[model samples]
Target: MLPKSILEHTLVLDIETVSAAASYAELSPTMQKLWALKAEALQRRLAEEEKMTAADYYPEKAGIYAEFGKIVCITVGVFTKNEEGQYKLRLKSFYGDDEKVLLQDFSAMLSKYFQRRGQQYVCGHNIKEFDMPYICRRMIVQGLPLPAPLQIYGKKPWELHHFLDSMTLWKFGDYKAYTSLKLLCGLFGIPTPKDDIDGSQVGRSYWEDGDLDRIEVYCKKDVFATAQVLLRFMLEDPLALIFESADG
Candidate 1:
């Protein structure tokens, strides 16, 4: 296979989200009512033994839904040619308790990338379904203006080539099942640096432990893993494309 460099003009991104409230007890009356409604739909999908009230499931489930959660961290990486003529992924992050501010900053960076590169891609695993849409919805919820890349209101599918998904590539057009990036990395034998935490524990780490730094590290590793998977899809050696953090 040809080593088509999707990374050249692509921005790799991953986000960490936590429940809007620390606990179900903390939700406002309106939100509590709303979550109960949402939770009924969630509960119906579970087996009998797994059934529970919406409040009981709130801690574990809320963060996954954009309506019930807020992004605490968004890490982005881009493949760059370093000083020694080696390729490195430069990473930048926008994160914190303040969702509006983080989203605004990320939007500004996205706008700049579009202006600078004129329609470069945004790559991630499951971004087409999760990351991209969640970001767009959250921006709308916060009343932020949608950047051009995100402004997909009436655009045809053919016009939206700037979004790439490693998981989608792995599907080979067979959309039968979902594949995890960690699993893909294992199959490709690409080393990952994700020992500390995982996606399931992100909400706890954020809400209970109050650790944004740890979450940021996890998100960054996800970005790297995503980039490496794309390289493997293109049949390129991931090691040769040196991984570097330009977060300074």
Candidate 2:
């Protein structure tokens, strides 16, 4: 049982990722030849050098691994209350395969949804910082045109007329410099899903197992969490949602 304002719009979001690519050395032909000639020498030198730390290990030709560059999976989930006044989960769209097709489909789907529901809002957890920026970069890379509705770079931080960040709302006032969706879900007594997959396993899943479905499910769970946060923010939270008293 929520007011109309809270159930007025839907939230759409997605994520992209790339798996372990060649290390910096493997990319350079000169370094490749060096490795070929002096494997032991290089290993010993690397072992001694601070740069050779375990953190520097990179999978060999892992496959187009880019930091905040390519998108691996795009999961879009929508939240709306049906006639019965019960919140429902609608996976509006889930696209993950070729990066180009995914982005195009994502943009098209968003455009269509916005066109039909002109005034609805779109939201996600940390979308402003990660998902949106990553998607934009991929679009630019593929030279695919971004639909008018998906053009979000021009909007101001607090002036997201059509987009909202669930994380932002949850971390009001003393908003921490870091807040993971999982962490916030825990604080709010929401059950965060536990799966064997994470961003780190994405590349392996994509290449070895070709299990985009798992990734899609993972992304959907995130969207569900985001929707839950929005629900709590706009209705369940007494501090945020002001309800009329029975006496009134």
Candidate 3:
């Protein structure tokens, strides 16, 4: 179980990403060539399991690769104690069509607020393998400085106290099996966040539907679910609650 102090210091987060371009045809000539190379490599691995061409898979799979995608939304949540000693999560999202602007805003929030609290942690589901690295790579591509919590280059495994992953925690050193956050939430009786839109549909929602607002709401739900999952791991009662903005 996580210590109470650590729970207070943790920042729960979730991100929504999509291919940098709406369609492969919209990419620059140089980027199109690069994607072709990436697609070739992926096709080799997936040849036996599926019979789809690179172009067919690009829209669905490209967003998972940081080099080929951009983050459209980032939702961050913090746990706060009320006078009654109950914990409530407050969430904020930074999102827009401009990837650079949103990334800059997220970085600024981390540097100015969370970084000031020494040894503060950022927690998420499958973040170590996906979200954290994706954010770091995109920041580098956009010429943004790496946030303090994300600068894990030279640190040993034992020294990585500032990064927490729900999937890794569940693994408990057994790395053979993979689990999804939705499955875990169901197991723990927490509401699944995928009821509206799963990760697979994010790219289409952004590019075709042009509904960033829908994407933002979905991202926030993910953040809430992730936080509740962490609470369960910490042996605390997971609250199946959603907080809305004052304007909403």
Candidate 4:
């Protein structure tokens, strides 16, 4: 595997999201409308799931998967080598309150990082198909500008000068089936996060109690897991893409 020094320019990111919802029956007309739309989307998604599990591919269903919900928050944790050869992660979170402002802040941070280092990459679990696109879409939704590095699509996956998705790397060959972050963590023997809270529960926590701290903690744990998986890739030398390759 490549030495840790070679990966000094990589950043690990993870995010949390919550959709618009109302807890009690009495709600404003605007919220009622948003809730209705979200509910309809959820029902269609459930139907699609049943059909998809039966070997049916539905384009509309895939679209639902893509556009079901909007991002509520994004937490990015950047890891790099210190002078002492130890990895340190610095973290920041963008709460989706005033999404435009948050996205602008995020873009500014990316710009600052790139200018400071000249080159850096994003490394995350399932980032290519999910997290990266979600961030881009959220930015677009807010009508905020995106930095050039964030627009890394349409290039050869291996030719990407920056950005690496751990799930993509793990799927170096076989990618026919879905593999989750939790599953890969188990394979690498990385301790998974405590299950007291999960992605599904975050939305409830956010809408019901306005719990940003819990969501931040959950996001950090995901970032930590993502970092651990990347460490295993760079240091453990267990996977074929690493141990068996000349690059190692």
What's the true lDDT of residue 143 in model 1?
Answer: 97
Superposed model 4: Cα runs more than 4 Å off: 21-68, 82-84, 115-118, 153-161, 236-248
Model 3, 1-248: lDDT tens per residue? 77768877888989999998888888888988888888878778665768466567779789999999999999999888777777788889999999899999899889887774346888999988899889999999999998777787877767776778999999999999999999999999998999999999999999999999999999988988988888888788887344544213
Query: Each prediction's TM-score against the native?
Result: 0.94, 0.72, 0.93, 0.73
Candidate 2: Cα lDDT at 99 = 77
The lDDT ranking, best first, is: 3, 1, 4, 2
Question: Candidate 2 — which residues are off by over 4 angstroms?
Answer: 1-6, 20-68, 115-118, 237-248
Pick out the ten consecutive residues of candidate 3 with the lowest summed lDDT: 239-248
Better of 2 and 4 by TM-score: 4
| Model 1 C-alpha lDDT per residue in residues 161-245, reported as the tens digit of each score | 6778887778878989999887888888877656789888998898889889999989988888888787777777776766677
lDDT of 4 at 89: 63
Span of 10 residues, lowest total lDDT, candidate 2: 239-248
Q: Each candidate: what lDDT?
A: 0.84, 0.59, 0.86, 0.63
**Where in model 1 is the C-alpha error above 4 Å?**
1-5, 83-85, 116-119
